[model samples]
Structures are given as structure tokens and as C-alpha cells.
Target: MLIYNMWPMWVIVVAVFLYLSIKSYKERNAKDVIILMTVVIIFSFLTVRSVNWLYGWNIF
Candidate 1:
């Protein structure tokens, strides 16, 4: 049931990605941070797309 709705888990994953991005920005190189952010953005986009496909929703 509710477990099938995984948007909440995605939220947590996004939060962790944001935290790592910020940490990398402060302590790591620019290219690494950019790559991390790009990966996270694509991951989020795919997640939303998959959810839309699953529920036939046009929310995005």
C-alpha cells in the first residue's frame, strides 16, 4: 500500500544528495560538486517521471 508510494523515500534521498552537494562545495573541487548536482537532478527528474507513469498523473 503506502510502501508502494515511494515519493517520501525519494525526498530523503534528495535531502542526502543536497547535504553531500553542500559538503562537497565547501570541501571538495568544483567539478566534483557539479557532477554530483547533475546526477542528483537527473535522478530526481527520473523519479518524478516514473511516478507520473505509474499513477498516470500529470502533476509534474
Candidate 2:
């Protein structure tokens, strides 16, 4: 599989998550930061897995 075809979108997703996480941290809202971090992880996993499936890649 060609990584270039897949990595860009994932990079963007991670970048956005990082930005949001930083913002939440600066606001000193522990709850939002925790929830946002959890959501970022779950969403990133699901999205990457979805892309892998589409490319017939066995992520497991």
C-alpha cells in the first residue's frame, strides 16, 4: 500500500486534535480536555481503520 495516499488525511486529523487539546488545556478545563482527548483517540482510530479497510489492509 502506498502510504502517501493515506497519511495526509490522518495527519490533518491529528493536527486538529492537537490544536483543540492545546486550546482546552489553556482554558484550564480538565473535563473538556479529558473528553476531547478521548474523542480524538477514538475518532482517529476509527477513521484510520476505516481507511485501511477501504484499501483492503488488515490492521489487526
The C-alpha RMSD of each candidate to the native structure, in angstroms, is: 3.4, 4.7
TM-score of 2: 0.61
> Model 1 over residues 1-60: C-alpha lDDT tens digits?
454477667767777887889899999678878987987897688678768867899978
Stretches of candidate 2 exceeding 4 Å from the true structure: 1-17
Error of 1 at 52 (Å): 0.4
**lDDT agreement with native, every candidate:** 0.78, 0.75
- Model 1 C-alpha RMSD to native: 3.4
Give lDDT for model 1.
0.78
Residues 1-60, model 2: lDDT tens digits: 454357567767777886898799999988888977887787678667767766778875
TM-score for all models, in order of appearance: 0.66, 0.61
Model 1: lDDT of residue 10 = 73
Please give the lDDT score at residue 51 for candidate 2: 74
lDDT value for model 2:
0.75
